[model samples]
Target: MLVFELVCNGTVNDILHGGNKAPLKLDLRLIIAAESAQGLAYLHSQAHMKIWHGSFQPANILLDQNFMPKIAGFGISRLITEDKEHTCNVIGDLSYMDPVYLETGLLTLKSDVYSFGVVILELISRNKPTHSVNNRLVRRFLEVHKEGKKATELFDKEIAVTMADLEILDCLAVIAVECLNLDVDQRPTMTDVAERLLMLNRSRRSQAV
Candidate 1:
């Protein structure tokens, strides 16, 4: 028999899709994002074995009673050696799959980074990655950001807008852009990703006081 701890809340997908209902606060969202990042960082670097969550999506992240994040759905995860840069027969959610992997049948840690970037974009935009207006959420976001538009324009109104919030969100947006870089070598590591989110979250909290 298998026993599982109860996760009172649903996945991030449920919260994002819960229209007309109360949405998650900005800080809470940031917390969730940070916790998820930490979890991924552990998998990618801090763990006894390096792991790649090939299917890192919002649906795969479970929330506990306190709204803390617990990464789930590792059915497709891979354990890799330090020297292994890529793998074959690439597999993952279509919307979150790294384009390089799609083209070369290679899976790298950066592939997971790209997927996480899409998740971050979903948290900010409240848009489904697979249901994007431009077919691909990352491309749309990159195009818009390249136009010199404020990143706040991409965010959902669930979080109240303040100058400080916008500043932090912008910082996150920049991180997201780097994560989605077409060149896998240009993407930040999971550790870098986690640190950046935590710093932004801390800054926001300090400003709130």
Candidate 2:
């Protein structure tokens, strides 16, 4: 028999948009990002039966007493059997849903990567879900990235204190941009994403030490 503990910190959505302006610690947020990426990596690759987190969003990531993230919403996820890659279902939050999946009902591994990218952007900017199909938050950042500018103006003022943090944040933005790439073939796998994030976490920690 298996049991799960209740999360006190609730979902990432709760902490970010829970009608409170109080800041979540940058260090903990970095940890959450790494852990969440690890969890997604497991689901995507290591699970006995490969699972697709059909609805990967901030609202589905729960935090425990340690503020460690546990992904929710597997109940709605589809299992990948053999070499099958997609299901004919249009499921996911509009804000974080992959545009290709929304249109073609072809949910691939890259689809979840796209959603994870949005969550990364949200963490950096503390932005909420954009109900509109045209996401201004994602678009503006991409534009800034294309211009090779740091776009420090878009970083959340509360957490953008140190030069190190800004540099780390810029790298995350670059990763997010890659994840949000229009060509699904160009996006990195969740394993690649998790490794990159873990490297970033380690790099940040080394700097603090």
Candidate 3:
């Protein structure tokens, strides 16, 4: 059996809910989102075959001592193969399940994209999908964005912010919205999201320096 080193910092969900009095900093969330996207991109873009991480939720995301996100839980993973009989009866978390997959019982790369979109939304909204009441939350979020509402309002209240960081926060919110598009075909690929997030991370780091 292969053994992996223990991550001292626990999971992303634990840190988010530990009542540390200080929530995760906006910059840290950005970095986490970017890193998570990179991992998903790698899984999806493998030249030999694509791997679908059926359960990609915050609880499955472990954090190292440095607070970096490492995606876990490949027990339900499925490889795209020529076998048509290999249908995935098991779906991801209710909050993260792609609507199409729920209806069709077919596991595709788009299902992973949909789940990643939910994770992105959860990161920005600081709300668990199980806690969310309606499907309209994403729609309402986009509507608010269109109406020029202050995007920082979407962040967790415990997180402190400066006026200078508002623009970056807004950009992050917009990206999250893009990921949550109801139509999977309309949503950006994990690879595209990863690249964009990488650019954003670099831009922020340059500005900080």
Worst 10 residues of 3 by lDDT: 78-87
Off by over 4 Å in 3: 19-22, 79-90, 131-133, 136-139, 146-150
Tell me the whole-model lDDT of each prediction, alpha carbons only: 0.82, 0.86, 0.74
The Cα RMSD of model 2 versus the native structure comes to 1.8
Residue-wise lDDT of candidate 2 within 110-164, one digit each (tens)?
8889999999999998987585857988888989999989869988888889998
Predictions ranked by TM-score, top down?
2, 1, 3
User: What alpha-carbon RMSD in Å does predicted model 3 have with respect to the real structure?
Assistant: 2.7
Better of 2 and 3 by lDDT: 2
Model 1: per-residue Cα lDDT over 77-106, one tens digit each: 644445775656566688887888777867
* Candidate 1 runs further than 4 Å off: 18-21, 78-88, 131-134
Mark the 10 consecutive residues where model 1 has the least summed lDDT.
78-87
TM-scores, each model vs. reference: 0.90, 0.93, 0.85
Task: Give the distance in Å from residue 129's predicted Cα in candidate 3 to where it truly belongs.
Answer: 1.4
The positional error of residue 36 in candidate 3, measured at the CA in angstroms, is: 0.7
Regions of model 2 farther than 4 Å from truth = 1-3, 79-89
Candidate 3 per-residue lDDT, tens place, 1-209, comes to 99997798888777766667245777888899899999998988954667777778888889898988899988667444535414557545777776676767776666777777777767767776762345554655677878978666666654436654676667777777777666778888889989988998888898889
